[model samples]
Target: RVRFRDPAGATRTGEWTDAIECDGRSYDPAAVEVLPPCEPTKVVCVGRNYVAHADERGADVPDRPLLFLKPPNAVAGHGATVTLPTGVAGNRIEHEVELGAVVGERCRDVDPAEATGVLAGYTVVNDLSNRDDQRRETNWVRGKAFDGAAPMGPVLATPEEVPDDATVECRVDGEIRQRASREQMVFSVPELVSEVSRFLTLEPGDVIATGTPEGVGPVKDGDRLELTVDGVGTLQHTVRA
Candidate 1:
């Protein structure tokens, strides 16, 4: 099932019947325009949520979740092109596909068991990065806070439809780059929700990026990205100047 939030601020939920309709024509899911299901107040991300991913990048594992934020202006639709800024020279951009959680209700200091209840649904997220810039500054904001860096969607899937333990995989040009079950997460969805809620109040439409697995690398102009979560759907996009 595909759940989408219309531009009018109303929610429109639909199933993948024959094809997705837009502008009076049918197109593949990847070709459709998308919108953020929620006008998020903040985009919270968990760093090193996956063990292998942390080790691959030569980063130490954290005892607790590591958090960061991406500005709201950085968000864009799934099919949107992410422009590389001229100011950041010699920077390599990487793609990190994550399973994003959408909060349904206001919550703070929520318990793990109750975390799942607060989730409105799930969506695909591509956390783009400037690796060289990141290493140079040792700060993530400049590396990740680029316009169109977070290309998310096709639509959202309610928890009732997509189980909490879905499989997430990311492919580039039809080659599998990252694969893992939700069960493999060092921190489960509910646990992450509970942990983040303790520090800040999660309001309706707020998003939490659960984190990406290993196999993350760089993508160049003209490269294609295909991110899929079983039972949810696939989101495809191309890199461009």
Candidate 2:
């Protein structure tokens, strides 16, 4: 599913195929302003879920999933430009590509085997971070949950549409920065869902970013980022200095 604003200055949501069809009108995708596929109240993110990513950060792999939260204000849609915080000296913002799962219903203490049943679909996410603030704080709120920190969407594909071992990649200014398969994850999607629900109730539209792969790096001003998850779609956004 996709959400966009038509040329007529009206908002519309519909299936995205060759074009966007809404109210008997066929609108060109390029002609409309695309919005995030879902309005997630909070984004539950898994940290160090990829072994190589953990190693690169000089942290040991956790025995269990490390979780964090991103409030709604941090959500940004595809094609949006993310502005880096400049007030703080030595603020280095980096990008981490992740596969985001949109919750389909409200549930808690879900079984791992039935996790997919509560999922609305999947989309691409860029877990932008401020390395300086992250290293200084324990909660990482300023580092990970800044405004427009999570640039997601372009489209949301149903669970059946995505593969069990889909590929996720991030390209910066047309150069490949991170690339890996879901198979490399230390915890599977179902396991992460089950584990997360154990702590809090997941409501409809909540997102779970299932961690990022290795090769994460810094982004300069005016850098274009393309975050892609196989079977979903690519999320394109740019960074402002």
Candidate 3:
């Protein structure tokens, strides 16, 4: 389900049937461009927050959260075509699909027990990366924060609607590449929020990509990438060279 404005600018909420008519009104989804569901101050991401993901990369599981930031320039809406920077040699772009937690209010040093109260909703995000640039530089800002690197939304799901143990999956060109249960997370969402809150203040709409599961791989031009959260929704993007 989605809450959006019609081309006429009237706000409405209902099932996203992807059809021309919604609630007795005929409108084309393609004609009325859907914007990113949230406007975040920053997009914070967790690294190796999943045990299987850490193990797959031969990296030690962190005792605490490994946090990273993807600049606002990276944000993109559903149906966007992510461009490959021509200057970067051996671009080796890859997708790290994960569940995105959207903050609902300003918070600092929040109690983990009350973390859920600050969440606006959850959505899907494809954490696009330049693996070659990442492997060559210690800092991944240049690798992960490129324009259109993060494709999010289609819609947002309330926290109450998403179970803690929801399934997250990624598919490339219709083939499943990564799959796991949220229960495999090394740090739960509340714990992650609390950990991040210890240092950075989270405002309404600030997003946290709760890391990815195993099976991350490279994507090439013309590939279709889809990130799906069991209770959230699928966010799809096209790769462009």
Candidate 4:
């Protein structure tokens, strides 16, 4: 598990086994600063890597893999508030729970069999989206690349601590919305690392957000999004106006 200073300037860590009191702090769990598990230069994400998710959206399953990027500035720590952009009235907002791979070592042209050796850890990530904006613009930048849109953490767990094929699930307001096993992924973690590294160098701390599963849907203000990757931890955030 990782440690972080909440908005109230208190150093709280998820590794601990007890509840942490806020002590009347004005901080909202939905709005907090995020620091990288390790310093990273890039965040690479796979799109539609799950056949069921791709089919649900009428997107074709890729022959290889579709990838995208989220700038480092877009990273938000656990409990960070995700804001809905002004005047994006008709856009639908959705929560995507994904298993994020944290690279532990720098690599280039890595072999799939050796990819796990380079992994630093794992973290739960919510890949927030604005569907209308994405569909209309023909580019994902504006839709998926927004401030605090990528809420990750609670803590990063070392590979030895988390079994590679853990289950990943997403819930909104205590109700399960998306569920899938890592075993269902069209591409394995090692394959992702090997494929991604073939195109670009991967540095320690760089994160690769493996694609979400089926059951993608809308969310609104005041809703709490809980993402859990077994053996890692749960990451919670609330939507705000």
Candidate 5:
């Protein structure tokens, strides 16, 4: 359920019981160093995948999946600090919690029916956005894809762990902000994988961010973001000015 660094600083794998067991040893979770569950080659994210999110943004629903990318450098581990870029406090840097599908095997031109077969597991992703740059520039490099923009982990769940429709939620300092079920997504995981693979190849350890629900708003420095995907564990991060 979790992969972490032991007190000795060696990487180990284990499942969550009441406590975590790794290297055939059980230890208090608070003593372990939690790492980002996956080292993705690339992070492939969808946009406006939820109908209500699209409606909130005053954008039309897309007939097909709208894809974007965040480089591997953007990933931050669980309990990490997400540094907000300077001068965006009033400009609207926001947090989006989404279901992240981790690719298991390399494949191309895979059908929707076979998409889940290529998945290694699922995790929670905080899709942080800088709205000012996003709206001012056509390319999202500065707006959506930036260092530490994607804080993930806490745990990576096997496909069997997630139900047909997992509920996703985002909270700021213990208050709920975003909430939705996977069923609310305009496109399903199968469709996204099938369609994305049609254009590019997917390799092992690549992450697909399924997108977030409505209720996305601004997050300030010192704000604590907790994103949960029900079956998948919660990812916690603090914003730093």
Candidate 6:
């Protein structure tokens, strides 16, 4: 599904195929301003859910999922230009391509076997990071939860559309920076969802970001980033210094 601004400046949600279909009229996707497919109350992110990513940071992967939170204010839509914090010297802002799971309802203590039943769909999320602040702060609130920190959407695909081992990747200015299969995640989507629900009730529209693979790096001003998740489609955004 796609959420976009219609020609009349109204926000609309529609099914996306060769074109966007809504109310019996097809729309050229490029002609409309794409919005974040869902308005997440909170974005729960997994850290080091990939072995190679943990190795890159020289940190030990936890037996259980390592999690972080990015509040609603951090959410940004496709085609948005995210501003990097430049107050600190040597600030290293980076892009982390991730697959996002949108919750379908409010629930707690979900069983892994039944996790899929609570999912609305899947979408692409760029977990924007301020490495300089992240390395210093324990909670990473300043590092990960800044305004427009999570660039998401363009499409939300149902569970049936995405394969179990779909590819997720990030390209900066047309260069492939990160690429891996969803199967590479140390914790699967269902496992992550179940674990998170065990800690807090996941309300509908909340998103679970399943973590990034290796090759995460910086994005400078004027850089165009394309984050893609197989079956969901690509999320494009730019960075501003």
- Taking every candidate in turn, the Cα RMSD to the unseen true structure, in Å, is 3.4, 1.0, 2.4, 4.1, 1.3, 1.0
Could you tell me every candidate's TM-score relative to the true structure? 0.87, 0.97, 0.91, 0.88, 0.96, 0.97
Residue-level lDDT of model 6, residues 1-241, one tens digit each, is 9999998999999998889899999999889888998988899999999999999989998899999999999998988999887684467888999999999999999999999999999999999999988888898988999888999997889989989999999999999999999999999999999999999889999999999999999889899999999999999999888
- Candidate with better TM-score, 2 vs 5: 2
**Model 4 residue 71 distance off true place after TM-score fit, in angstroms:** 0.6
lDDT pick, better of 1 and 2: 2
Ranking by TM-score: 6, 2, 5, 3, 4, 1
Residue 199 miss distance in model 3 (angstroms): 0.8
lDDT winner between 5 and 6, please give it.
6
lDDT to native, each model: 0.79, 0.93, 0.85, 0.81, 0.89, 0.93
Residue 173, candidate 2: Cα error in Å is 0.8
Candidate 6, poorest ten consecutive residues by summed lDDT? 83-92
State the displacement of the C-alpha of residue 115, model 5, in Å, after optimal TM-score superposition. Answer: 0.6
For 2-44, candidate 5 gives per-residue lDDT tens digits of: 8788888988878877798876789888888778888888899
Candidate no. 2 TM-score: 0.97
The number of clashing residue pairs in each candidate reads 0, 0, 0, 3, 0, 0
Clashing pairs in 6: none
lDDT of 2 by residue, 74-168 (tens): 99998999988777447689999999999999999999999999999999999999988998999998899889999999898999999988999
Model 3 regions lying over 4 Å from their true place: 1-26
Candidate 5, position 157, lDDT: 96
Report the C-alpha lDDT of model 3 over 1-241, residue by residue, as the tens digit: 4545677787665556666356777666676656567878899999998888898889999999999998788888877788876777686888998899999999999899999888998999899889888878888977888898888987889898788889999999999999998889999999989999999999888999999999999999899988899888788889888
Candidate 2 local lDDT, residue 94: 92
lDDT of 1 by residue, 108-144 (tens): 9999988889988888888888788877775677788
Off by over 4 Å in 6: none
Q: Which pairs of residues clash in candidate 2, taking residues 3 or more apart in a chain or in different chains?
A: none
